[model samples]
Target: MGGRLPLFRDLLPRGLLGRSVLIILVPILLLQAVALQLFYGGHLDVISRRLAGGVAGDVAMLVELLQRETIEDRSWIFREASWRLDLALAFEAGARLNAVERRASMPLLPLEEDLNRALEERLRLPFDTDWQSDPRSVIIRVQTPDGVLHVEAPRKRLFTATLYLFVIWLVGSALLLSAVAVVFMKNQVRAIRRLAGAAEAFGLGRDIGTIKPEGAAEVRQAAQAFNRMQDRIRRFVGQRTDMLAGISHDLRTPLTRMRLALAMLPRSADTEEDLSALTADVEEMERMIAAYLAFARGEGTEQAAPADLVELVQEVAAKARRSGATVEVVAPSGLMLPLRADALRRCLGNLLDNARRHGRLIMVAVDTVSRGEPGDEAAPAWAQITVDDDGPGIPAAGREAAFRPFASGAPGGTGLGLAIARDIVRAHGGEIALEQSPLGGLRARLRLPV
Candidate 1:
């Protein structure tokens, strides 16, 4: 059962269009299949039986007429049966269905059964009916004292025209209707796609324009809710940014005055160290303020554009190498995604800086992978970016705590790297996780939908 779940999970579609069409189409197909089975099994069988029985009766009568009439006179009777009864008559000497100078016949089972039963009840003499003996006719042999009488009837007698027409109409109508449904379904899903795309872009903190809701009523309602939510989030971020901006402005002047006052103090060894300490504290306070303002203002002011992830990671690696950090990278070419390039770059920069500061050997890689079945293209694939390093990794207990604002992983650390990275990642509709890397240190894995 556990194994079966994965098989069905892989087979099912991952998108609205495919899923919706599948949902509508599967039952229709099944119903048609059931209908076909019922028609073929029940009604078609009855029709074929009646037709075959009629052909068999005509065949038996032709055999009887050929048996009674003389050879010369039989030609005229044959012509009469051929024209009136539609049975082509022939008489052959010494032809037997037995093994010596004969062959067994393979008949279409439905026709064969009906013809055999009808001929048995109607005919007094021994006879052989071979449904498959001729492609265009039903062949019957009647054993007589003089010779064997061969009777040929048109094969169309064994099949009803209405049956063929019904089946063809059923199949053709099913296909035509399915195609029309697909066209309408694609249009309906198009509107839903627009709604989903807008929501995803907004969640990623991009400056998203409004979406015109055009789907079913429920879908339109969802889109309206999404728009309202976006408005509220933007308003809240704007208010917070304004407040933080005012506070930072008010505190800077007093800090500068205090710094100048300390610098102008008389040169005394007793107070110099204390003044230096105060200066460092003020600088740290300013750094915290900047980090706070950055976080508060990150409600998505950037427009989205297509950016190559591989090149972005490579550029980060090159810059870190220039600063004397050993970084190894493995990435595929042409890995493009719609993103806020500057914000993503800053987010990755923070993670790399943090890793480089703690670990000696660092590695970065960008790859695309399926969330479940690897080969299924329809299953959603994620673009994954991994940064690994050789340093003591964070404990499982502190991993979640590390993403909290102002919660530093180490002593004397600002503790905003992972938090900011997480914020930026989540805004892009991605996820970041901390885990133990193969290099014996923390591994930062980031994933974005492609």
Candidate 2:
């Protein structure tokens, strides 16, 4: 039983539902137990007191008969009153008295050594209490011509019965309530779980269809709101992607014409400077336009197959090194992560390029893990991709703004690199953040959920 308790405990999440139910039920059970004790004790006290009062009356009657007979014949009265009451005759008057004397008390006659223990074990309460301290209890008194007898029975026996009954009722009730709560809560959680799974798929760029709301009204409202938001974002993205594609296509013809005209111009010393400036301006404009188009197209949301992340990083690093950039794969071993092939590579390539362009030396590392089961020790299921550099990192205040389009702080560069990288990463169900690196510069940490 003890072993199974831990097993049951592990099946539940550390959530509010379990805690709330426990908080509510525990006190109620305790209260019920206490109430049962008090109620049973009260009932027993009433019964005992009535019986004691009846015994007192009978004793009084016996005393009166003895007194009258003694007044009439003193010797005869002494002989008759000296005889012990017969069990058979006592039962004829009251069957309960016979049972009490015979079944409850008969064994304690001459066995003085075991008398107290026997009575307590058989007829006394299961637990002990001070009956003398309690006002409500049975008080038996008898008066004879020779002497007076007094006895008191504690009300603890009643309390014990009540306690036992309370436990029985409580256990039965709690079981039924818990079962019902499980069924109802399961139904509520099922819909929410389904919605969460769908949301995860959506986050990972999977085509999740509209979810039908379920459970309580509030949950349904939240599901509906999410659906509406998703639809709006998708529609806006589709419209913008088409618009950017058209703009890029249209701008290319005029750009081609301008380049041809510039090339056809007569050559001169001043013309060379003027043409270089013209070309630079055109190229910068073109690059800005391309970046805008990429942003508008929602490039990250594209569906791509899984690729070897380590290999991808290695290839990017190789390319950068060939371009005379100081980028190295510090810890690229065992980086087998499930990821969007093109998008993930693009993200890493952009980050390395950014580091080389802004920072001095660049270092990249990857680690993969699996999430653990409840009560079972295991690693978290995710892959962390870290890009570290020893460059003049962006200030804390402007770090957030650096991801926005055209928000660059470097000379001879557009500020679109980080933004594009983030979009691509997020589309693959990953997050990218910039923080102080161990390399004394900026650290780009990317976490991808498996």
Candidate 3:
């Protein structure tokens, strides 16, 4: 039962619009089917039997009347039967009913069965019925002692026209109702789709202004809640950034004064070494302050826009080469996706700088890859960027720790490179991970949705 549930779900439509239409259509079809069964099986059956009985009784009465009269007198009886009863009759004297007993050929309704049963109850004589001989009438032959009595009875006497009209009404009403459901459901679903797209864009640091609620009441409420959440988040980030800006200004002023004082100190042989050490400490403090600010600011209010990843990788690699690193790039001609360019540049720079500082050979590669089966358009594709180096790689156990702030594995490092890189990548709705490279060093892999 558990296994079958998955199969049943797979067969159903996945989208909101398709599923909604199915929900409306299934019940309507079931109701129509039930109605058809009741009418065809019960009411229509009764009407057809009564109609067949009337036709059968008329034919039986005529046969009895002819048997009482002589051959010359029967001519007048036949004429009366034709005009009064609407039946065409022919009496063939000294002729036996020799034609084969014909059965109905795929009668659509119960008309044929009703007529045959009625004739048996009324006539109680050898007879045959040919339903296919005429499209508008039934041909019946009664084998009497004198000869064969042929009767052509109009089919209208044994069938009701209301059956066809009822079927058509059922089908037409179902179609009209289904169309209305689709139009209304599509509008509702469209509103939800807009909401989802807005949320995704906002997550990637793109400004998709507030959504205008247009769907059902529940959907309107959700949109209102989302707008409120966005406002709160923006306010919090603004406050934090303002506070950090003030701190940065205050700290830089003292560091500037300290550097000036150290420069003005008198140069003496004994104090020169101590002065130099103090100067180096001040400079290190300055670098730490800058790193801290960068880490705290994150993506720094940069709006996401489409940019060529291949171009960005090449540009970063060029800078690495100028800084005396053997940087090699492998990427396609073009790959465009939404990104905060400067933030991403800093991210790539940090990874490349770390590799250059520790390793001799730096390798950068970029490509697009699917997160699902090939040719599955529903699955997302990712722009994959990999940076590999030949330096000694961190062990598997310590790789995760390297992404923490102030967890530098190398000496004289700020330790926020990996942390900052991960922060920026996550802001762009992408992921960054550290792993062992084939080059016997660390590999930093970034996967950004395309």
Q: Which candidate leads the pack in TM-score?
A: 3
Q: What's the candidate order when arranged by decreasing lDDT? A: 3, 1, 2
TM-score of each: 0.79, 0.65, 0.87
Task: Show the colliding residue pairs in model 1.
Answer: 204-427
Per-candidate local distance difference test:
0.80, 0.65, 0.90
RMSD per prediction, one decimal? 4.5, 10.5, 3.2
Q: What tens-digit string does per-residue lDDT give for candidate 3 at 1-450?
A: 999999999999999999999999999999999999999999999999999999999989988888899988898888987899889998788888876856666466888888889999999888889888798989889998899899999888777889989989998999899989999999999999999988987777777778998899999999899889888988887787778878888998999999999999998999999999999999988888888888877775898889999999899899999999999999999999988899999999999999999999999999988889998878999999999999999999999999999999787689999999998898888898999999999999999989
Q: Answer with 1 or 3, whichever has the higher TM-score.
A: 3
- lDDT by residue for model 2 over 1-450, one digit each (tens)? 999999988975576556546655778777777876665457544554444344334334444554465344544533443353210011011112211222222221222113233334433222122223335543333333343323343333222354457568877887887777767776777777777887877777776878999987877887898799789878887888888889998997788788888889887997899997888887877877887787666564657666777788888889989988887676545465567777677678778888888777998888764556655446566677899989888777878888887787777667788888888788777778998888888889888876
Lowest lDDT block of 10, candidate 3: 99-108
**Weakest ten-residue segment in model 1 by summed lDDT:** 99-108
